[model samples]
Target chain A: MAESFEITDEMKARVGVESPPWTFEVTTTGVRAFARGVGYTDPVYYDIEAARKAGYRNLPAPPTFHGTPIYIPGKSEETFSTPLECDITVDHGLPNTIDGGKVTEYYEQICAGDTLTCVTKLASLDLKVTGSGITMFIQTIEFKFTNEDGKVAVIDRLKVINH
Target chain B: MAVTWDNINEGDSLPELKKKPSLTQMVKFAAGNGDFNPLHHDFKYFACEYLGSVLVQGHFRYAALGELVQTWLGHNQGGRIKKMSCQHRGMDFPDADITCKGTVDKKYEENGEKLADLTIWTEDNEGKQNSPGAATIVFV
Candidate 1:
């Protein structure tokens, strides 16, 4: 048996607590790499002329590109946390961590050169007793991404499972 | 030949899209995605902590699914993908053969726009599902 942390009531109370905003830039270099990395062949995401012909200002932020973190130039990479922002290390001594799921809604298109700011919070925390007699806590974190124009571009809800 | 609104029906299955993303692919994706997390490429940390040799980014899998859907719906100018959701069921290690498969859940017309709902996912070499998700695409 692994050492387990006790889930405290205080930890349960921290649900819905919002974290600080994370700001990042959408660059063409990042866009092309991201597109090709996933084997994306859309010319709009690669060739500039193709993009302009497709009616976008430039390479647009691929659908889930916001999920990727931006490493600002001249800044320490360690300074910024990964996209999964919730601190799972609470009093609860959960031994294993796993990603549960993602629910995302896209409102407006995010184009290259657009600056984005993401504000996230622990949206919900729930404890369940499973068939295996194990106590599991499912934490849902919500991320709000706003474009430079101050409009909501994408809203993502991610669920984390700790057991 | 673009997949138009009138061509396909519900219960139809999309061809399986498979790939074993190379290390070069992961690195390139990490560079463009702005994610330099050690868990992605560092074998020691990933094995010790995440119980995997090297992990593929969750969004990386999503990108593959996106491409699969776009290819199925055809890259024509009229189709628009409105939303997609993913439920990560398990971890995918580097160089593992992952296959994507899906079925057209339903088809309908909303305000004159033809649309199809797809239930999709990616599985590991063992055929265990890693990411199960859904996508909504509007056809021309």
Candidate 2:
């Protein structure tokens, strides 16, 4: 027995709407902790001199470190737990959400002190079938991060399923 | 530790890397990375309501894979990860030794810089792939 399904008209209209771009300032502690959290012990990710020796102005973030939204527009850290990374999410009243996958492409370096802007848009929503003959809805969202100088730094594409 | 262009070849393998992640490490990642998804923690929420046990996060696997690239290619070295992607196929727990491996699928020259495309995947002790994907790195 499966649960009931309902998608409100408001949610459907929200599709294709991009949330305002949010900005996150890269920091050393953030980078070092990000490196350590993943069990990476490279000095360049920790020490300033090591990073310079490696030919970087400062430590550039590693993959997936920026997956979560670290900043939001018009939000203060003192008021909220954390800044929401600007993203558009369509809630179609589908209780069973699925994880499809994530694709990340890097262009410029996300060095320390570089303020990056992240803009997200809903790409698609479609019906998918599972191996067990279950009907599912797939939602794909895309986010592009631009460096301070306006050059593209990275683009993260995420896909999820709603059942 | 520069991953010079001349030292790599097509079909070469990036050295394998393994990580025995701990609960504390996962928590730290959640706190630092700003991903406080309840699924990654909250014992009761994980055990009673969710996937039997607290599933190790997809970010952990992705981050570990990133570490493998940085450790092998050297982060500051001219080798920059142009693109890295992962598709989750299975659920993984925190208690397992996650093994990450990659193979150089092809090598070419782009914009006067050497580049390599890699086929990368992560598996558990059971040899079951939890996440599989591809990455392209450029060595300048």
Candidate 3:
């Protein structure tokens, strides 16, 4: 069942309102496997000492690692399974939402041994019916990551276009 | 390390980047980015629903721009990207070759730092702009 919503400017305005904080732990094996899964061989993503030598406090997860959790919503806890990066909205009966795009500013380095809490909120939604008879709803979502110190490490604005 | 700034006027083009869209490359991106969103990997996902065929993930093309910035500016070493944004203008289907592109719209000094105002995008097999965006690069 594909669920459809009436997208309006008000809906876009309602985007980014934070939901309950989703807390998760990322391990070194998790980071390495994820990096390998993505074809990124950057040692900083897997090797702790390498990351430390690279000036990162701990083995750092890749910039898009935060995306995995957001995409899947709720699924597995372990690291190296079938990297299920599917969108959670599908559970809501929505199909794939294309990312119109995003603008990411990496403020602080995310290091290993740090348990980060990801806070997500609905940002906005715009309904566009293409000339080709396809209806694309552009939904914007925002994610914020806070470390134990309450320092906001990363703020990501994700734009997803789903029908 | 600081990004070297040259006098780039409006209408200047950055070095263009070329790539091919492949299922194997798509899988690599899925593995590296950890974004195996099935819509990207499963042909049936597309065949049965949208587009009637598999399409490249939008981010994969944008990643090419990120790669260009890394290759040219040397990753985080190029000072700060400050702000960057792009939109999906078209689609790049599988097995099609494409190119990543950027242009210097203007150059100026801000907050005592040199900056380049630029536009970027990816072109599909037919030489059409697929993903387009603008960026501000600050040099130390």
DockQ for every prediction shown: 0.51, 0.57, 0.35
Question: What does candidate 2's lDDT look like per residue over A8-127, in tens digits?
Answer: 577677678887877766888888887777877778878989888878898767777653345544663422224444446775665676577888888877777677787878877666
Docking quality category of candidate 3 according to DockQ thresholds: acceptable
Quote the chain B TM-score of every prediction.
Answer: 0.89, 0.89, 0.84
Q: Give the CAPRI rating of model 1.
A: medium
Model 2's CAPRI class is medium
Candidate number achieving the greatest DockQ relative to the actual structure: 2
List model 3 lDDT by residue over A1-163, tens digit each.
2234564454455554566676645667656755554445567776788777766677766644543342243454233222133222222245555567887665555656666777666766666777876777776767677877888876767787777
Order the candidates by lDDT, highest first — what do you get? 2, 1, 3
Cα lDDT tens digits, model 3, B20-131, are 7578878776665555577677867645266666678787776667655544554455444655667887777777887888887878887797888778888876778888
Q: DockQ winner between 1 and 2, please give it.
A: 2
lDDT of 2 by residue, B1-140 (tens): 45667877778787899877777888777766766666777778734265666677787788778877767787556677888988888877766788999888888987887789888889899998898988989887
lDDT of 1 by residue, B15-103 (tens): 88887887778888777666666667777774436564778878788778877776676534566667788888787877789998888
What is the Å distance of residue B115 in model 2 from its true position? Answer: 2.6
* Candidate order (TM-score): 2, 1, 3
- Error at B115, model 1, angstroms: 3.7
Q: Judging by TM-score, tell me the better candidate of 2 and 3.
A: 2
How well does each candidate superpose onto the true structure, as a TM-score? 0.82, 0.88, 0.71
Lowest lDDT block of 10, candidate 3 chain A? A82-91
